[model samples]
Target: MNEYLPLATLLRLLAVLTLTLAPHVGHLPPWVSALIAGLIVWRGLTAYRQWRMPGTMVKIALALLAFVGVLVHFDGRLGGQNAGTTLLCVMTALKLLEFKGRRDVMVLIFLMYFMLLTHFLFSQEMWTVAYLFVCVLAVTAVLIECQHRGALSPRITLRKGGIMVLQALPLMVLLFVLFPRIPGPLWGLPEDSAAARSGLPDQMAPGDISRLIESDEVAFRVEFHGPVPPPSARYWRGPVFDHFDGRAWRDSVPTFASGLSSRLELLGEPVSYAIMLESQRGRWLFALDMPAARSLPDDAFIGREGQLLARKPVTERRRYELTSYMQYRLAPELDEHARKRYLRLPPDFNPRTRTLAATLRTHYTDDEALVTAVLRMFHEQPFVYTLRPPPLGRHSVDEFLFDTRRGFCEHYAGAFSFLMRAAGIPARVVTGYQGGQHNVFGDYYVVRQSDAHAWAEVWIENRGWVRVDPTAAVSPQRIEQSIEAALDAAEGLPGHLAARTRLRFYLEARWEWLNGRWNALVLSYGPELQQRFLERLGLDDLRDTILALTVLGTSILAFMGVLTLRQFAPEPVRDAALREWQRLTRRLARAGLPQRPGEGPRDYAARVAAVHPEWAQAIHHITQLYVRMRYLDDPDPAGQNALVDAVRAFKPRSARRRSWIRS
Candidate 1:
């Protein structure tokens, strides 16, 4: 089949394969991409130049080399998602070298489809969906071209394939609406499902969140039931860190005590909203500060430290509804053990910070007053709020507070928490996102990784856990507006979050709104949503749903099958000129001057004119008219009419009459 395969068709296949494999280039190893590219070029050259394919030994050597390369690149484990995808890509490229038969082409096409499916493992955004659709259409067109006995125009082939896909849309919709949806993703490897996501970490050090501030990736999106909380109150709580080990703060083992409800005091009007949280691959979930215990997601609870957590890591995008109180008191009465736990700090670290805390404590004996004094110091001093803070030494808090006043939210929060602990106050660092950008077009807020923040949560005698953002004291604009506004002009914001011109901002807003709609309407369709939709459609019973699905699905398929058959069914003769030409040929055949099988109108006319010289002029005239009207580009309308009229009026002479004329 390789010998007979058209260069055009081979090129088409290669083009589709390239499109299918392009998205993976970012994640696949550089060598793999380079190798695949080289092989594709080699295949194209081999087809075009008619070069011989690699020998069996050469093929074996290439395969073994690829195998070894993949094994070495993946640390000898070929079982995981990355390894398997790499192997598939390499094998697909290798398959190009041995394009022996139609079966091989079919195998390659199927592999392309599989590769296209793997794209969803990384992203299911609207652009990805549209790209995959185009790739599918291209692949389908190539598949159709492969089955043709003769060359067809690329446009015609593509149109036919597109028609087939459009005809199948009804069935696709039926299946999508009625098919039973599993709880999680339909296709994914558990081990690598959340590997590509970036968000808050469980631990917070001097620059942990400051580094996060550089990423534009979305952490989650929130659609509030009412007005969104003010910027100062929009602290999406994530992990709570009570254990500060010198340079970093880490979360203690979450205590799922039954008395969590008793410890949390809900106040003010409850803010009802739903969060479409992106996968962070962590057990902790983020909600507005002080999420109510009663309004928690299933298999999730508020930890003793007031951090919302789930039983399992968020391996996929999850939408959960919760009611949180912007104003709430937590753990009003702190026990001795808990107080000590929150106050504990690594010894012999940040001696200067400890000394400063002791000095501030003597000045202001009242805990609340002392807190205010530290905040005042931060506000009055020349502490700079910047993303590019200098590197911290072993005494990070000490250095940030004294030596270099430049630091991010984490730095300020860490120093404040350390000072509070040293001054005999129960204080801990609370890490989460602080501010969200509102997408007015979508009526939702987009919380990005850039919004990741840390603040001090001090346990006052009667106030319980109070939120204290020392960074706000240093740079109040960070809390009031966005990080973009808070940072100096010298500091750059994430690409997506950077300020834009009015037109560009509008365009970005529209695009984000479209993506939000896609996520809500398409990606959020899970088992529970499917059930609700079916119920609304009066498909309450499982049997009824299945029955309806089967019936509707079969009907759609049957309709599509009939349409397909009609499309492939032979077309009737419709051209008047061609019909007249056929009639003329039939008349000649009856006179025993039949047109030979492989004879064109001109050739048959020439043969007849030679046989009967008396009819030569007339035969030549008819042939000329027919050829011009039938074959030439945009023949004159008068010429077509003349051919039809001439064929109708002219009658051929019989063999006897021709012989008589000859004698």
Candidate 2:
């Protein structure tokens, strides 16, 4: 009935709570983090100093203040995922101040569990899962400590908690495998669930993709069914930008043309592959160039411009299979409206570049020849392919083409597209990823943000849209090798993309392979996959599947229940000295001097000595030796043997004989 809590127990709870809240520190507001930290410290101090609990009015005021803070920080919106997580954290911190006894601690521990679940809302990566597992173990240990009748050592409590977790593992696996998964995610994802992801945007400008090149995050990973595509053929298509506004290139209104199949002509043999795409929070699904219509995923379709797109934004890691051809003709016959759309440019920008385009056009009467000339010029000129390019003026393409002459892929693609449009060639800039690093250990290609690229797609008379990469003309290494090889040694690259020692490379490759397996085998286990697995097990019918799940689930629960009950089962006597001591106690009980419950050896021995004064010396000696051997820090083996010998030698008469002697 006591409302008091031990300091050690309180501190253990705080430690676990801190562990649960650590991952949110990166995304939670700084003020919220500080408030939580302050509250935690104050709670610890209150427990240590035995301070009174916060008054009800004070708790109410604190709650209101936290609500206001969340509202103000989130710009008056509290319904979104971020706002909700922040509020949950705030409420948890507030709860810490009033933590008094068993009820409050239970509430706090449950809150910790809920907060731990919130992390998966942001990221469900392999590392995130591992971290959450550790947090769960720690929190479980603290919970066990709370229920214990007496204080338990941290090691003992953790061991017991781990045993419980191990016992439940079978049930967990059964539920995960047999639970009838619905289509898509288990729950509706909040709007902001995919916030803070990085990849190619819906638009591209001079520095947009170049900046993306600095990030080493994987855009997607591909496992080719047959031979892997060559480096030059590894252009994963994303958003196509046809509308140029001088400074930026934006995607035109998408027309999911009914005649798309008629327009696209596949030339070369198709390359089939499966892509495990990371969340980019955009509708554009990157696939190899010119994805075939037949092999497209059920939820995705090829856009009017030949780029693959999802029906909805990819808010989680997704796996999809597709067939694409390196050689293909998209929109073989361009209509007037589409032609005008691709060629339209701002009237007053890049005058010098336009003039140069005109002069090149004049020299080469044929459009293909003009395109060849531009690429040749890029190859012959002093244009440097570098990550750190000089800033451009208002006429960005003009500056890059005439003055600076050094830029990343986006700059080259933008200038090339502008010149093609200027010279009266229908052209547009296509932004996506170019080269990917093959994770040899996993036998998959990892396309990263650093591989993000922009190239010009110009329409020709018979070829339809021809892919022209001006950057490749300047530096072939970028296409043939990697971004690291493309740039000079002095130009900085992301740490993961940079060169590493052989040992480090090996470790990283193994880790990446593990991650790939986790993603493919675990995170990508959706409803369809579950159904396939169940069908393999001959549980095709819904009723059969549910019945199997129930039977297996009940069996696991019953097994775990038996294991748990065994832990509480009384232990059998094992030690020789203890067995002899028990025999002595039995003899005393027969003589009507039974050892009571919770009686210690010394106390029992003293009471028996009082009952039989003649045997006091022998009883005291036995009890002293037993107590020393059983309870002392370092009792000798000799002492244990001595206690056993002395208890065995001690003899007592029955109660009737003792009473006769006393009479």
Candidate 3:
């Protein structure tokens, strides 16, 4: 294989392979992929004019320098994205050296494989999967070029490469379906692979949600099996923060009191679905209200806070199955401590709202009636909800209510809750997104940053707590029509968020539907589903080690099979050289001289010369022709078939052995 492959062609193909893999590692340090591209470009420019490769010592020094830079920049923790990316990037740079042979191309092919794995570490998105496949094809193309470099032109070599990988599709799919699902985070793996999952944190500082709004990334996605719930009902309860000290909010308790039972249940009309919440580096589960049963795994616990949380920090694409009962009621009976905590407010806070709550209290008969008055004030007053809210001065709850009535959801919810507590009603602010866009493509919903909302939930008689949104008083269309429909400005905003083109509308709707299905089904692969999945396939005790072994075994055997077929298959070379030699012999026999089969080519030419001296030059030419055509066709293949014509008309006399005395 090494003997046949031409070096120059392999280098060109490897350049193309490296270039094709550029986008997979786009999230890494910007210059990493750029440096690789630069290296490839340099090699190509040099190759185009047949210049010398960069000096060997220079390559060695660069590799050492790149490795040290990766170590120092990643702070010596050479693992996960920081490590995999470094390995891939530096390897591509190092590959520029020794890239002048078939084996060199093989090394590049391996590097490309590692690059694909690095892409998975950053994002396992379906589209990224598709692009990685294209990278794999490019790698395969280089391998095929290494094999047939000299025998075929670059265009023909690429065609052969495509045909080969396409033929390999069946085996790849068969292996993917049969691959076992690993039960947990890979054994002993480091924690940094999930550098990309950005979930809402449990602790709430003054500007916690403020920074989150700056991001348009999805925290999670939901799809309904039945008629989709209204955007107003899209309350995804996650972590419950109660310990507030005027400046920041923390958990009431470090550990959940309800334990795993909070995520489980006896029975209900199971709103069957899956949720793939991106890792938030915390142990909270973001689910629709009232999870009927927790279907993740034994380790994932349900807390009394009405939150689904894993036993450990979610360091990967966290997925779980849930059947939340939309109609299920939270325990209406509040414990002594829980009630006291709900009413606890900063002392001497919001003097004006406190006075107003007292005035309203005298006007209303009961706590429930007093609650209606607060919402009424928002509706009747000139209070407005806008993203561009007036900058809150000190004493936020006070400034928002009396001074600047122009506040967003958080402002309204905060001010409204503070007033309710003063009126002798236990209330808390609930902050989450509102009015999700309905994606008809997957028949589900998508919530975005613009949908970030806050509202109030008040404790009332008979009912545990009822939801109230003062912001809704100002923007009714927000709950009714979704964030997209609530947009009043058609001119200003980021191009991505602004409604500008009809095409944006079409694509957003289309991809929203597709992403909804991806989250619900694919992102939902977890433990309970793992067991049920195995049970459906009739396998128990699925082990990570076993799955790893099976995939490894199949890959090795398949690779061997490829090598064997290439070695044993018939070689497509010219086998007709002997016929040309025989033709020359027959012509000589007709000219009255014969030669034995054991005679050598030069000896036969001598015999022919004695028989007919005038035809000796033609006879001599024909005998030698077979040797050159049969053995040598390198560098150039012009006049490859012309040798046959010279032999056909030759005069090598051997009638006795050729035709058993043609008479």
Candidate 4:
């Protein structure tokens, strides 16, 4: 294919586009973007003959340098987000030099698609999804352009491809909403799953939960199958840390082995609901503390310590059904070791505070009075709850109580648990987000990392561990307000700004409604949903979707075959071969041989020859004309009429049917 413009120039243009791709995107890291941009300039100069293409040896050496540079930039480990992104950037840059033909551009398009998938791996928020879809269309546009040489304009190709994608949208949605969902990652340990943790760690230093509070990213989403739980009833309890290291708390109990059925005894009214938690890389789940039962798909088991735990680390989105008793009795008998861990204090860490706790214990004879005095101190004292707490060095609880008494949930929880332990009351910390932006549009709570908070639970005589939040005594508005208001200022945060204005608030609300569907539907899929899908479609419990799709695919192929045959049917054969019939009948009638209407071609031909011998030749000529008109599809109306005239001119061997006229 000889070309007008140099294919070399077009190829170089594509190469430059590939090289500059990182810079074009905001999502790509800055250093990579800069390097890619520099490569584009260098390649453009080479294209202009400002410099010859680097010598073969030089190119090879430079490629090795780039490879080493990538390995270094990605911390030498070849996995996870940073490494994957670095590899993509390096390939994108190197592809510029190696550009040869259209196929190479096709490679770039494939890489672009992989890049889109990477974006989904990080965040599947609605805006990200919408942006990535546009990117998909763009890459698809490039794919279509590569298929044709010079005939198709890129603009026209893109438009056509977009139209086709739009046409395919209904089918995609039908599959998305109706198709079954499966729990866990599609493959295995998750492509980028080194991000796993042992659930939200049961311990936190001074800054842990507050740092969690800086994020607005989703932790989990819940949808109930039955009666909806009120907002106040929605305490998605997670980790219960009984072990306290001077500053933080930890998992005091042993790892649950199997079903501790002996430890569990069902009681009180149960509230059944489901929780779809995003991958936190942590093992502990946020339940309402006493989940009565769990989804069969989920490997949920209860601990003797009365906390619900997942069977595996959550590396992918998870959804599980849970039934909980908001008022269940747990650990009617608190063991001595459990009591010690719950009431343990770090020696000599906060001595003065310890002394103060001892004094409070001496002052208040009853445990109820002690709890009342602590809550009253928070209420009456100059203790203020604020997002930006002053940095505490050591003796953090002491600093929080005396000096910079203004701090968030962690401070309150840490101090409250510390004081309870000091008063000889067994208490431990509970960490989870409190309050969420209630979506007015969808009526679902969107608890973000910013909503992360801490509180204490005190084991009492008759009742189970009673929930208490010291922070609530300071700022009652914090729990009532969204976490953004609790945090007050959005400074130093990545993307956790509040929607303060009506317009922005409305826009944010609409965006969140869209995101909630994505979270509930796409990101948070599990095995139960997968089964329900197959069951709904009338498939046997034993069969799977892949087998079902196979059957459907085979049927489609068979139907397509019939349609294709109809599409290419011969039109010439369909005109009834009228000219041939007319010619044959006329000659037969001249021979005193009448032809019947709708008679077979072979039969008519035979009868005409059997007529009077004088007109036998004429009959033969008419039959030959019929064959040519019907088989060859000769569009010769005049020739056909001439043949008819010849038949009339010759004379008939027999009479024919009167219906011999041809339209």
Candidate 5:
């Protein structure tokens, strides 16, 4: 067994296994990856040294330790996606320790294929898919090597495996195109599978938005049916926080007022657009401030605060069509409940901010005049729009407004909302994404986490809740251009933005465009898209889809059958001596005496000679030449030719039926 399975084959299998498990490292626990690496190193060393494999008891003990470690690490919750995947990965690595035979190798290869699929559960990005494909090819090559006899090179195995994969492409494409597309599970994934998203949070603390500002990960993508909205107008509203607890601004009871059909008195022509929202693991959806969608999914609805919310958390990419009026009035007739909530603030939170608001209130008579005064103060104040800001004391808003005066959008929005509430005007902090980069190639706006912005919305007597962004006052360029443009040249950008040359930036933008295409064309392919695709194929309904699938599947099978027949067709024996020897045996059977089954040439010849002694010399001589040519190696071509000639020329007469056959 050791002789058959070479060190090179083992190393190649280990290399492929490493690639299959590499992507999982980031998702699984750190110890899991480390343990896997350690096991691989140990296995490789053992194979290189030709050492005896681990015994059954040792392998069983190690497996138990791995199982216990996984359970303890995940706190005994071994059912969900991450936990199950971690356990599978740990066990798979341990399987390498007891690599006994071909059966064990086959099991590992099958498990590796399953592990590759789990990677898509975490991320379906184009780069990840491409990387997984490479891993698949490598694993397939190792599988081929397992079945193959003799010492073949890795390159040959890889070539054969690649050919096999290419041949399977036709069937894969047929299945992908014709397969019935169904929606995801109605109940959604397991609770633990729905990992927390990294974008906006429902609760906004002092440095929540600041921390998000560093991330370049996309929040969602929007494709405008008409003109793309200007950066100033693209305020995708998310969570509305009216309850302030001195340190963090939180959502009030009214914020959860979704599932209720509320009509908005839209004033202007609605901007029709489709938003491909990334799963944020929360119900809150981002849209224009005054959004009005004709038909929302059963799980989704527009909240009373004009915020979109889902009945359940979003665990997959959701593409919903919405018509939003950038210039529209929302909740003009404000109720007392909402009014009181917006104006409600902790009593002893920020004394100085309240005093300043009072002074401004005394100076400005009307609500509009007070709003203008507040805007003027924000514009005139030396408030720096920076990600890093000085830590605030208990009075966060007062410290930010009076002392620190340096913070991100959260600080400005919090301070402005406090000033509004202090001046007796109902206000709330609106947290959502601000500007988005418009991709020229794909014609979609990519809103990123760094674009996350917070602003205050004040409800006046007649105008309702007016959108106000104090960050714009401090850094207008942040809205007009981008976050990078707004940051000071001396302060520098984060890793994603910093050290990016023009060429690198261009390449990155192009890569984003490709990723956007993948998201739209591949990942977004669901029931509706499948139906549309079927319509093109004249398979509109379920009956038609099934029929078409049957026809195509049958056609594929028929074609495969023909290829299979061609692949395994019998070929004539190329050995001249063997072919001639087979002919000699047939001629002897034509006589009265025939060779019995499982009879060797030497035995058969002796039996034939006893029955017909007249051909004894020829039979004995032929058997000797045949055995030497067939069983033993003969380099002389003339020797094989002589054997063939002798067998064909020697025609033995039948012992008893020769005269009767002649008559």
Candidate 6:
């Protein structure tokens, strides 16, 4: 089997296989990728040394071992993207060992194509898509070489392959535009598609959000149809934690009291916008604080505490239109269940913080006054807003409030919520992004994970859950400006956000704008966009779309076929001359005057003349001219013209006699 494959083809196949597996390294188990690399190295060495391949039994044993390893590593769950991709990768590596002939190469190449598709399951970023396209081109070149029987120059093969891809681009674009797209997932998404992203977690531990502040990954991007909201009003609400354990805050089972309709009264014109959210592998959707009651996406619902909840986990780039009113009230008249839930706090925790809350309650008569007193305390006290805050013990709130008055937004929000609850006011922590950077190039706001924030929402008798940002009191710049502007210059921000040069910053913004457009126009192209595209072509329903597609497809196919035939078809006069020469040789062979291999035209003509003396002069003249025109370096144009005439005029006398006898 190995004898059939040339060394060049084997090397090319190995190169393509190596590159195809490179992108999956980060997603696959470390050992799996490492095993692949080792196998590739061994295969290359074997090919170079002309060593014998492993036996079938040995290959089988190795494959079984790899399969067992995958099962063990993936917890015996041979389902979804992770396990399935791992299995694919393992089997692909094993396939290299069993490489025999062209059939195996074809099978290997098809597997490579499938592996290329799996790459998009994990990432659809601009760079990722570009990388996959380049891989496709290389794989296509290998496929072209496999089909070619004769040796072709590397440059020529690559050029022809590239041309083929370029030729297909227009048709591909047409299909993408006219194809009937299925809404949402036509098939179940692989579990590996969902990854852990740097966003608000379901539960907030002491330093949970502080860890997220360091990451500059964009959580989402928002484009306003009307006007961009002010930074102070841009509170993108996420998870509302009602259940407070001793150490952390988590959402608990909803009670009827918490579910009571707050009947939010809109004060002004709603701000309409569309958000392109990055997948967070969770159901929570980030919306501006105080969103309209019914302004959520079709797949989303407003939770009891006014947080947007998606029906399914967000495993892809999701675009949803939303209208939010920054100024609105909910549950102004706090219900009993709501009071019990929001104000409920674990006993035997944060004794010192509770004492201070009691002290503040005695000093202030009303709930509003108590809230103001807490804000004043945060402002007057030496509460340093820093990313690198001292770690707290079990009593996180007490330690932050008294001992270490240095913390992030979570610290401030947690302490504030604790004080409010201790002072007999219903309060809970609301976690989400606070501010976003406005990209002038894109005309949209980019909210990064660094903008992740938390603040207190204390329930007032007359005024529902009033948003109290204690971090603002401690550091007003954080609310007004960005995380970088708020933090000291000594603690540099993540490299992407903190550009060293003005030109670099401008280029970054431009690239980001291009990526934003790519996501919206390309990645977000779904059934609705496809339908709208067809509507522009006067094709409305599925039936019309199919009909129009059939017509367009047939026309494209016919045009392509015509182009192909034209490329392969010969030139008229040149083809006729060559065809006549071949026919004369066949006639001579039939008359027992056949030319022998390596016999020069002059030698063959002499032999033919000896056998049939009647055509001697004609044969001699034609053979002399044919030799001088084709083989000799004669610049005279008359040689070619005379050779064509001599060949057309010459006729084998023996064949003519046979034809005459038959007549």
| Candidate 1 accuracy as TM-score | 0.84
Error of 5 at 37 (Å): 1.3
Report the lDDT tens digits of candidate 6 across residue range 1-663: 254456787688789888888988888999999999999889878888888999989998999999999999989888877898889988998898888777888899999989998887677789987887778888888888888765566787688778787778768887877778766554566545544445688888778998887686779999999988889889999888878898888888741122323556666778999999887767778898767757777777777777888776775667888998888887678768868877888999999988998888888989998899889889998889888889889888988888989888988888888889988999998999998888999899999888999998988878887899999999888898877777855366666556547898778779889989998888778776676667888998989888877888888878888988998887665543344455567778877778798886678888888877777888877766666565665536576667667766766755578777989
lDDT of each: 0.84, 0.84, 0.65, 0.66, 0.82, 0.81
In model 1, the Cα lDDT at residue 232 comes to: 91
RMSD of each: 8.7, 7.9, 9.7, 7.8, 7.6, 6.5
Error of 2 at 548 (Å): 1.1
Score every model by TM-score: 0.84, 0.84, 0.71, 0.77, 0.83, 0.83
Model 5 alpha-carbon drift over 4 Å, by segment:
1-4, 185-196, 254-263, 295-299, 570-663
* Cα lDDT of model 5 by residue, 211-302, tens digit: 88779888899998998778988898898888898889987675666633443667777788888887676788788867765656556788
lDDT of 1 by residue, 1-663 (tens): 245568888887888899999998987999999999999999988889989988999999999999999999988888767888889899999998789688888899888888898888788899998999998899899889988756668899899889877877788888888888876666556465544368787688877897787787778889999877899999998888889888788867654433577888889999999998887767778999878877898779887777788876777677899999999888899888888888898889999988998998889999999999999999999899888888988888888889999988988998899999999999998888888888988889999888899998898998899999998998889999988788756477666567667898888779888887887778877777788889999999789999999899888888777876897888877886787788888888887789899998889998988876767777788888877777875767788788877876676756447687979
lDDT of 1: 0.84
Model 2: weakest 10-residue lDDT segment is: 187-196
TM-score of 6: 0.83
Question: What TM-score should be assigned to candidate 3?
Answer: 0.71
Pitting candidate 2 against candidate 4, the one with the higher TM-score is 2
Candidate 3: lDDT of 6?
48
In terms of lDDT, model 6 sits at 0.81
**Which runs of model 6 end up more than 4 angstroms from their true locations?**
149-151, 190-192, 195-198, 254-262, 498-500, 572-663
Q: How does residue 305 of candidate 4 score in lDDT?
A: 54
